[model samples]
Target: MGASDTPPFLHDAIWQERIFNGDWIAADGGSHAIVEPATGELLGRCGAANAADVARAAGAARAAQRAWAATDYKQRAQVFRKAAALLEQHQEALATWIARETGGIMPKAQVELREALAHLHEAAAMLTQPKGQLLASQEDQFSIARRVPHGVVGVISPFNFPLILSIRSIAPALAVGNAVVHKPDLQTPISGGVIIARLFEEAGLPKGVLQVLPGGAEAGEALCANPDIAMVSFTGSTAIGRRVAEVAGRTLKKVSLELGGKNSLVVLDDADPDIAAANVAWGAYLHQGQICMAAGRILLQRGIAEAVTSRLLEKAGRLPVGDPMSGTVALGPLINVRQVQRLHAIVTDSVAAGATLLAGGSHEGQFYRPTVLTDVRPGMRCFEEELFGPVASITVFDTDEEAIALASATEGCLALGVISPSVTRALRIVNRVPCGHAHVNDQTVLAEAHAPFGGSGSSGNGGRHGGPADWDEFSQWQWLTIKSEAPQYPF
Candidate 1:
């Protein structure tokens, strides 16, 4: 059956186009269209809310925040557990939507669906850990430092990995008893968001504690500027993130942003091209290179640059690209046509500036063929910018010093992968890369659920959302002191 003939499961009654206030409120104006990027077919439509609607959601979150904050950690954990189970029961539907909307292959979409559920379990487990500490003080005096939720948090997610990234922000915020107003990416909002809202509601989450507002910049701006929201957690472009930080900064609200990346993969001369190429191929092409942490830049040692690049090209050619719903596909289309054009522009500019096109570099209906470029320099669009597509820019480095310099050349510093047969060389490269996350002999995309996930520099702000440190980002530290007796002082 053709993609156009497939039923629009998204338009069903399950997605009750309403804003959560324990009851369905009609969707506000500012309508947006959802499309299947793979075929450029309309999937559904979402009701966009204006500034007033965003404020209403924020207000509801604030009211719920107070009561949720007073709930004990164990009770909060129980709710997350229920949510996890609910997702597990609905895995088939959730995975299908993830594949359809985000244009993710079945395997990758399944992985995200399973991992998202596990994340909720981990968040629930986080509740069991220590939350406060007693400081050493003078006799008969007590001092305590507690990690407390920052009331209402506004989470704005990007289009790539919608389910995973959105839930990452929401899990931590809600786990710590903070009410959250989530604004999913306008491109693929309906499917992932409707599932999330339903699961949370079925899991007995308190109404209004978590609300989904699906729209564009207008809704995002409203949520960010709301005074009731104590913090903003954003994962998108650095340009927008900077603006969000500025606006939130004026309100004195804490902001955590995981933004753009031109992340690099450094392969040493001693590395085996077979292993390095395979790992790099997966990192660069997974989800059609839509991932922000993808290794778009490859700093190859001059001795083995050709061998590694050749192997990577061979692997990239074999990956099947088609509709994400098909089980046999390895890669899917870009999230939308705009993404396809942006990636093409990056490659076109790079080639025009003297970079060599090493492999596949074509686009068709939002689908970008896996591509690699050689001789990429600092000024080229592919080298300096974030190409959120399946294009890898390879540059040869004569020495370790040169490799480190190339990795650090970009404004983004989210993650880097150092591949070397020698542990010493891998350690050296990992230490030198100026990024928040680094991997040795592996792709940068391999993230453990308990490890910190965020970036440094323009790639992100200094905050994490998926590790033991995640709770720390959504919370504020409060110090309390008690005195056993009053002391008399004489001047």
Candidate 2:
């Protein structure tokens, strides 16, 4: 595949150009070729933005912020509703782009589209909700504290779960009347940037309200450091997220960081091994375990450790891996070969450190086999690191205290899950782990448009983005007062 062979959905001027100031324009850094992760073939070309390009985007967003903020709230909401409808009309085509570009199976791609649509609908609903609360004043006057837009919000999304992550922030920011300057990951730009720009454009969003610039670190840093941007929403690795916060903090911009996670799935002795294995497989291997909420650590109580390990091994061996576009397979290629090397190193190091590799510990090209390891101790590389791949490490624990300690050991505490026959037992374990999201008798991988989602510690800052949380993440508050007449002052 090459630029000439680009899919019809992406074969347009908009797909190759940067979107800002209501039109597609050339970037200062020329163009970069997008490669299909599964085949290593050229997918197409996308405009690459530099610092200058990011500055231009910031200026455009700032210029349009006031008018968009002044627009009627209901009308602003209609734009999102229209965008959601348009997404439904083009869901199949968009999903195909996601599958091909991200090396995700068709089912996973459909889920991303569904969640993205849900985000849009939820954002539309947010616009119609109450904006402020009235308060009683000590004097004969009325006072209120109301939410207001942050002017221009910079959105930086990652490649994994590109569509959902991007829209989760973009839709809400726009709904609350803030202009956006977006920078989608360079690896998967079309599905994340061009598609969003096109949807909003067709949905009657005014020019300059939403700017999409697909770029690398240079552009991302520029967007964060720009003086005009009042806030930044970032989703990526914790290392990069910290850098974003540092840069944006210099200017005192509100920053929302949704970073990495070393999530765990705790299997209690009272749980059925078969049921636990199913959830573990799904949570640990979905989309090749590329999700931030993936179950990287599987902590098993000693009593049921052997049973669950056996079932997990069977599940791992049966999962099919191949090119997603050519055939039906449960697991597809990772984002690139670099990721495969990193994951394989972690598995190899763990095995060397005495962790038993019960099942697959290898890969062919970008397609890594679903791997299972047992006898993994806390100090092993696999247990300590964030294995963002289709690899699960099992650590046996003798008691509930041990389980909680092992599950909460990782610095990144984004998602945690507990499986037990008794809901009370599961709740006890769930409450002990400090994570942004938790599931009882379920898997770790989960997200909803109407749920508050984020993390603490190394995972992210305390900021969250979803449902009512969106009001705080994307906007600020303003206090107002009214009186029938001027009152006497202290002076």
Candidate 3:
């Protein structure tokens, strides 16, 4: 695919320029080319914003917030309802763009589109929910505490699953009456930023209420430090998240960081080898293992380790790897050349450290085979670090206690999966691990729009999205008091 092969929907002006103050305008920082991950082909170009552009976006969001907040709740809800309908109408085109840009297969793209639509619908439902609580007050006065928007929210989303991640924050913030300035990953500007801007625009969102800027680190840092932005919602790596926190902390701005993970899936002795292997294959290799909740490590009980490993190796060897846009393959390419190199390096380093490469350990161009390593210990690079690629490292444990210990060894625990014949046995291990999401007899890589999604420790800052958590994360409480007459006070 070349520039000429760009999707027809993306030819619109909205996809080529920065969306600022409800208008499509050129960015001060010029533009950058978007390359398709699977074919290394030129997809299109999107505007790249500079610090000045971010500042301008922040000003616009701040200016529009008051009137947006004062809009009728039903009207606010209608915007999200319209956007949700539009998402359903354009699902196929959006899914194709996701596959080409993110190197995800068609099924994965469909999943992302469905989740994004759910987010919009959830945001619409949140509009009519109770917003405050009545409280008893002394001195014959009535009092209440109500939720209020943060004025301006800065949303920074990552490349993997860009549509769902970006919309989860954008829809809720806007529905709750906060203006948003979104900065999507440069690698996926069209799917993440352009699609969102167009959806809201068609839904009749007012000018200046939402601004979309596709840029790099300079723009992200500027958005964090801007005085007008009251809150920052970021989804990326922990290293960059720390920088965002540091910058936003200077002005005491609220920051929500959803970072990286090195999640684990535990297979007990009672688990069927075939079932356990299926979970491992799906959890570890889906989307080429680029998901933040991807299962990075697999812990198997000693009695069943050999059986499960054998099945897993067979499955890994059979999975087909190819370009998602060109063929129907189980696995697709990594996002870029750098990721391919990094993933290969992690596999080689682990092999050098006594890990037995059972299935795959090499790559051709950007497509890395579904690789599996057995006898991987805690100190190995693959065990301790977040390998955002198609690699699964296995370690055998003798006891449930040992399995729990091994699962919790990593610095981040975004997700955990436990497989056992008995639900009670699975719960016992799941309760012992400290993860944001836990699954029993299921894959680690799972998410729902109505669930509170976040992590503890290095994975996130205990800030959650979805359901009631959205209200807490996007709004603040304000106390109100009412009386027939002014109360006397000492002067």
- What's the residue-level lDDT of 360 in candidate 1? 75
Q: What C-alpha lDDT do the candidate models reach, one value each?
A: 0.82, 0.90, 0.91
User: Per-residue lDDT of 37-131 in model 3, one digit per residue for the tens?
Assistant: 88888877888999999999999889999999999999999999998888888787778888999999999899999999999999999999999
The C-alpha local distance difference test score for the whole of candidate 1 amounts to 0.82
lDDT of 1 by residue, 221-264 (tens): 88888898899999999999999998888789999999998898
Query: What ranges in model 3 sit over 4 Å off?
Result: 1-10
* 10 residues in a row with least lDDT, candidate 2: 1-10
Clashing residue pairs in candidate 1 are none
Best prediction by lDDT: 3
What TM-score number comes out for model 1? Answer: 0.94
